[model samples]
Target: MNAETASPILAPPLITFDRVSRHFGGAQGVTALDDVSLSIRRGEMVAIVGASGSGKSTLMNILGCLDRPSGGRLLIDGQDVSALDTDALAALRNRRFGFVFQRYNLLHGLSAAENVEMPAIYAGRPAEERRRAAHRLLGRLGLQDRAGHRPSELSGGQQQRVSIARALVNDADIILADEPTGALDEAAGAEVLALLDALHAEGRTIIIVTHDPTVAAHAGRRIRIRDGRVVADEGDDRRGSPATAEAAPCRPGRSGPVRLLGDVASAGRMAFRSLAINPLRTLLTLLGVVIGVASVIAMLAIGDGGREATLRRIAEMGTNLITVRAGAPGIRSLADLTSLTIGDIEALSEIRGLAAISPERNLRTTLRVGNRDYTTMAQGVWPDLLVARSRQLAAGSFFTRDDIRSYAAVMVLGQSVADILFPGQDPIGRQVLAGRVPFEVIGVLAPRGVSGGGTDQDDVVLIPLSSGFMRLLGRSHVSSVTLKVADAGDMERVADEIDRILFDRHHIRNYQIRSSTAAQIIMSDSQRSFALLLGAVAAISLVVGGIGVMNIMLVGVTERTREIGIRMATGARRRDVLIQFNVEAIAVCGLGGVIGVGLGLGSAVWLRRLGFDVLITPMPAVMAFSCAFLTGLVFGWLPARKAAGMDPVRALAAG
Candidate 1:
């Protein structure tokens, strides 16, 4: 039996459309396909010919399952195609049909072989098998030498051939070619048509849509569609019928190679490659996110550290310790003899829940030890003052209770004051003169670095309170009262007790009693406020970074318009286009986020080295990363939607 005689009898129609029509727009409607009905059989070569606006491309879309008929029964391989939803249509297209567009829709960053593997990738083929199949298809298409070349590096003809190879990679039953030779020269066009013919001979169904009569002449049957209707259906004598061609040496079915965990790995690899291709833009877009993350982390770390240090210092002072300083009475000085007396401290000490109370007075005077004389602030208090203030003695011993009772001239010098007065000599047991009175130095205080308020507590002198009040100042007044309570939880009650005691003893009313816990709380609240302020400033940068991402993604959509059009024309669903572009944007922003995190941590380390007490703990790092990724998603969504919703025909025309 000759190849030309047996085609129609052996071939089974794979596609059938019964009175299908598609319309666009709302209210004022435009009909894209009007009552179109057609049938395409397996193992047959058919062409659809029409001028622009004749609905040939629309019919091709319906045939490829890219778009559905508005009001008709469409069937593919005896299955009701029009009844399937969008996702089902996409799955059917992936499993049963392949598409080849005039403008090759290869990813710009990928090599030719990678582009050919895309359909199989969408079909969820394993990596190794997909790669092997892609290589085979490329080799078969006479593009083995150009397999590693990017789309930009290939000629228009070569790109089209790669697209053809991709269409066949899935081994789909139907191949829909929409002006497959439109972008090629005569020589390349003839070569592509020959490839299609060879595939048709292998018992594969092929449909070509074109306006060129010469292109349609190669098919065994040609269907002329005009105004959304089939104007002519004619069988050509030049090309033999499909049935006899199917009996000839058929090409062996190619099975894709199986790979373990292929989908995630392949998508990640593609994402990485795409990012590597545009380094500068990715870096700039991530700058804001990085700055925001780093700033928030650093600020919080510093604030927390400072708060912890302050609280530790306060705890060391004594868990339930409280201080009462005599403020100026209207216009009177704190040192005025008419204000506080020793009776006030004795009264406060006798209150319930009170542990101890010490009266204190401060004097600004010059200290002289041997030949060295320096000016320093002196705090006058009893022997119990050291215990309430949590002072640590570095050398010698603190003043005894006997010294306070006998009014002995004794003093404790802070580290800095000791260094200044004694120089290289030991200050313990040495006599130091404060203004006119002389006192024996009993101890040298330990070094306590800078406090939260930047005050150097190691630059003062301590003396017996009675000696400072009676002998030096020649008065019985006290500057402040220090008290320790039995329980921290009873701080408010104890404070009230002390206030009542002082008010009763001095015959005064409306006096305030402050606790150390309140001070600590105030300090912490202030620090938290500062941290929030810093975070707000940093958030502005993140917003700017998000804007940068949105702008770049919009630009990317514009730049890849033709690529998007080609993908859509090749049976990619609207959601698929949306996801692909969104993934690309996410990939770019994610790369930026990774780089920013590294930089932020590095900056924290650098600041710590500069003595700024910075800590980039795990929580802050995690928060930073989360912020970066979220920014990408929030900013990249609109542009991705724009790219996905673009009209394929108009997008292709844009180029």
Candidate 2:
């Protein structure tokens, strides 16, 4: 038999519509369906024919459970469906009825086999079972070779065939077709009609709705609807006889951890697959999140690194150490240390907590060794200065007190100076010239990376204070005095007492006094404040990225409304769509977060290479990743909720 004729094998009515009515909005809104009552026995081919705007499509929607009636009792076999929830309806659709739409409504990004397996997945079939079923069905349809092809890769007829395969993959007993051939030419339409006819002959009850006369004529019975009402019923009145059959069993309820994980996996696959379809749009959308997360990590790393470096340098000077630089009162250029004689140093040595005091004087001079001259700071300090400033001799001991008592020309070279002037050779007893006087190299100080005040410490030459003041420059002035305190608790009090003593001796308050503890506290507070400010600024970009995600997802929902409808009609619940969108949002931002981590690390390395002390700590990295993920969830919820709340029929109708 062809599609137009049906066997007289009536067993029971598989679907019944009893005075069903559907209204849109309210009494003022349009009436889409009104008082429609009808039934079709099993194994019968029925066609619903009407012009545009007639109630035929509404009737089709109600039968397939894609929509609900405003008022009426609708039954599938013996079960009433009007009181069912959305999830229940979705389950009913998955196992009972398969739909063929006018536009095919196949998801564009999915392959033929994948699209055909959609209903099985919602029905909770195992992956292997779903795969086997897809294979069997594709083979049965004589389209095994085209199973991997996407909708865009197929012709109109092939795509419609794929849709038909998808509808039947769940082995649904009744097939509902809404203008299945409307979009096809004569040849493709004929091919689809032949398949429908073959299914009808196999004892499957079929309902086809169309406005085309030739398509309607192919049915054994024809019901014509007009203006949301049934106007005429022609052919086989006895086919409406009352009969009852058990409704298809619903799948297990959607709950539990396993089901949740499955739901998430499915949603993730769909989300990522859809993203893969339009690569450019996906990449462009990911840009904001990437840049924002990257900025957060990079900025925080730099600020923290700089702060730590600065603090370390300050700490190197000694927390309880204080320095007094000589100067005259009311002098603006106090940076120019005028003079602090040995008398002033001796006067300050009596202060409490004065553990070890080192009076220091420096002169900028050229040191000549073996016909090579190097411009360097020539510092003259007492032996106690080494112990006060945390210095140690690498080769020989520092000069004795006798060297200071007598005007000896013995000199101690800094580690860097030793390396430069006497490379690969012992400099002990080697002679270097300073200010036209030959000095013996007695010792070399150990290397210090970066000095307390942010200068290179290993680039000086040390001599006795007597030698520097007497023989070298004929001067008896100390440029600065560095004092080490006995106890950290009394550092502040000690500093005050020393300042008073220095003021009394030097008779000037204009001199500068630097307390290591005070400088440390100030630098630490400033660095913390600066770090927080940078973090706050970087967080702004994360917010912007989140907003962009929200905006783009909302637009995505609007654009893919029809696809949402198709999924709902096939068996996807509201939460399924919601999860799909949320997963997409998270995936995009999470990937960006990862990339931002790499980008941030790269930036840190580059800054370090540029001579900036940048630190990449774990906390900032953690914060950046957290911000990115949070942005997605916070910004993506509204759009996902909107999509989930949409009516399936209305979504289907959206352009």
Candidate 3:
């Protein structure tokens, strides 16, 4: 009797159930609650007691907005909740009722303080404000020193205290506790019941659902439910006057840009906390993204470096130089081989854009000096040959125009030929035999590396065109006419002019025209194709990494089903849960991307040290990072949606 029976209930019922019914497995399946009708007044301490499978828990769940009835209307403060959406239900739960579970349902990863601050977080309270409130709640609950400890570090009673603190974080008026002291010892249970008494003294409605008769005895009003029906109502009529509950209205969080940013920040923090729980699993998930991004950046760098090397080689051959070879377009018959003559070179020289022109006759022969013999290519040209081919003299001067006019037996030896024939001695003024013809070496050409065809370019000798034609070949026609255009932009025009002049002179098309400009174009196309091929290969790895992310997130959703239920129970909306999981996935990929970029640049430098050309640029790193982020966003969606779409009651019931 005492103080419990003395306190009168003043209410136009705060919660009402007008014949609510809940069923599982369709209408003919398990009937958890059937035609349940009840009304609880404001500031009343009511205990709903029943045995197992008696629908007491179902009634409590419906009262707390954690589950919806299949039939009939449930009202809160005279407002029907049957028409409310999931978000509206969640807001009502967060602002009106505070739940304390039998098992204490505290997230094992979060500290006590963090667990207490959860409701305030969903309430959209600022960080500083939530922190202070959480600490104050923990101190009042006698767990201030254990605020930083995780659930596993706390005893069962301490954890329950922390759960109570979390329930009261948002200052909810109606405390719906399901078996609050069922998992506690006798002393702890007494302490909890005393706390409930204190809350009831402050004019808050308290509803307890339990199977223990001793626990039900603490409430002023006892309602017994058997087989989903209220069998007996024992205790005095506490409803004295028809007075409405005047609890403070709850704010539905915030809105606009500021709220969105806060939600994002909170999601990020939660993501980190959850990921940190299993460090090895998080690391394994990150591995795939890291490898994919690193491979992309490194492959692109190598491709770009190779292209640069190729283009430089083409430039070395000369971009503006054109070659007019004496042959038909495809077939080079004996008659077509003699189509280019000295007249063609002279006519091409008269073209407006011609910088220098040289007529060349080539023959592969053995050059011998003092019994030392070497097989090499011998080319006959004028003094302008050096300028046309961009050749430089290493020691001596090139053959003069007088040597061409006089048909002098003088030649310039390429660096490779000079090294083989002259050995350690100077080649200038030395006599060398080319196909039994003695020739004086006037100069030695500087070294030119291997050509694109993988053959040495410095293994040749140059002689006067007149000497090669009259003394060696005994012919007037030259092997080829080489021209150096004044400007690269004028190459096409000058080639056309040369074609016209040559057609007028020979009266037939018997020569093939080629240019280094065409070679440059071919090289460019080849480089692009090679780069794309490399990129495509690397992109496959990125796809694999994305799949890995999807698989991990799916497994994560399954493993954290209970956590999701806990969040939902605390008033988190579906979108909030979605954003939380999505932010976790993105954070994983972003961290991996940063590490991958560093690894890729380091790998590029390592390749360079190993004598492999690698061009490292910022664009590839940025692109790889962006791709990683996109991979996370694309792959994380399905799992986040799955988590968000879960039924909170089923999720909470999941093991």
Candidate 4:
């Protein structure tokens, strides 16, 4: 070599190993490097050669900062690296050393250009800058045309070229090659060695670890390791080992807000790319979250719809109304059915704040018009039934109070009864026999639909109380009394006054009074509880989906072990790996959440079309989506932690 070439080789040592020993398992376990001491100067090409299990690869790993020494100090650029943390070592590898692996170690899902940009991403380079740099490096390596191709699409030689471009992307000063030509054919291997030679020619330190003598012959110096120790050192007798210098201070690079945002963007892109590779698996993973969110949304909407419909129906039944029934806690006798009388109705009329009052005398009786006879409920009520129960007339007029006083047999038919008894015809002025007692239909009540208790409120016949009692089966007692309050605020006080009057008359609490407002509150509370219960059950499904996410992520981490090692070797910190894996999980769930919301809305619409009450609100959709996101976060933790805590050397050794 010329004097100018020899001068750079004789400078201060760039890497020094002082009694370094690396033991796997424990101190008594297998030792990969035993009390080894060596030094390499700047701008030199060195080769470490050994057979299988001879510790050459271990030595290369320790030298490249991918693995740590167990018992001794390693110094780079005259500074001891033994005390440095993992992130500090990562920064050291990023700023100073680049690695080229035998199998190329190119991420399968990333494009050639994207693979080459990996190191610069960890270095926090701008996206456009990294793209330009990656393209430049690929072009220099003669693979620029294949920049958009994935690793699987490239030949072995082209992939190796991409790997070399990746190594050089960070502008590192030292190149560490471990069996770089092992997987390539002879011609491809020669081309790769030639690339290494060209790199060495540019004043960069190069270290090659291989078992092949032909590959080691390209280096100027050769060192042979065997049985965890250096057995031979040849071809560099002129250069002497340099002393270790003082340990220098190092601070790992801290990512700023912009850099963090950039990292998130990069992670998001990578997550989508990874998911795109195996679409079936991604879809399967998303199925659980989608179903869970859809169930939650649909169920809550159904509950809300049912509640609103019921409340509306109750409001339609007069919210300021009260009904008094003639049954108490212990009154099960037949005479209890006859306990309420017209005198009680007259006594209740004496109370103030009463808007309207009606006495009901109901009996299960058969009505016959011509040869057609239908068994139905016969209700004997006063004139105030229309006002008290909020009933409206569809045709004709209601029975007058004089009709009740004179024992005139006139009756009003409910809508359903009118339809059944007098089909498609006006029942006004028509005579219907109530058990041989003829009665004229004076009016037909409008449809009231089904009550909350599942009873048809319009399936009844109304007659004058006095006529029904005196002329129809001689019944003198009333079944129930319906009362409408003038003011809703006076409902409780009015109920109390009625109770006192009934108690003074009957001398017992034999009557039960129910107010519409109280019923509304009770029904609302029950509905709310029902809705909450449905949500809780649906939330269980979401949790189960989250568990599915956790399981799939664990498998994904296993499958991407080597990729994790590659990123770490290229300067990615543990937090970066964690963020990458975690974001991938969240992306899966987020997409599922969107699809699930659409599905839920469609389901609700279908249910509504099928005659079910379904109410859809934005808040439920938002809540369901938010729950899906949180599920991903909670369940992704374990897999992300497992990936971040991986040992890079072991991970790289993984298939």
By TM-score, the better pick of 2 and 3 is 3
Question: What global local distance difference test value does model 4 have?
Answer: 0.86
Candidates 1 and 4 compared: the better one by lDDT is 4
> lDDT at 459 for candidate 1?
90
- What TM-score does candidate 3 reach? 0.89
When summed lDDT is taken over every stretch of 10 residues in candidate 1, the lowest stretch is: 244-253
Cα lDDT tens digits, model 1, 516-618, are: 8877777668767876776677667767877888898798789778877666654566666666766666776676677777777787788778888665678
Predictions in order: lDDT:
0.75, 0.83, 0.86, 0.86
Shift of residue 377 alpha carbon in model 4, Å: 3.7
Listed in order, each prediction's TM-score against the native is: 0.87, 0.84, 0.89, 0.86
For 560-648, candidate 3 gives per-residue lDDT tens digits of 99999989999888988888989988998898889989988889899989988688889999999999999888888889999999998
Between which residue pairs do clashes occur in model 1?
Answer: 7-243, 129-257
User: Which residue pairs clash within candidate 3?
Assistant: none
- Candidate 3 residue spans exceeding 4 A from truth: 1-9, 236-244, 249-254, 329-337, 352-356, 364-375, 382-447, 461-476, 484-496, 515-519
Instruction: Please write out the lDDT profile of model 2 over residues 58-122, one tens digit for every residue.
Output: 88888889889999889887689988999999888888888988899899899999999888877
Give the winner by lDDT. 4
lDDT string for model 4 (566-638, tens) is: 9999999888898898899899999989998999888988998998888889998999999999888889889
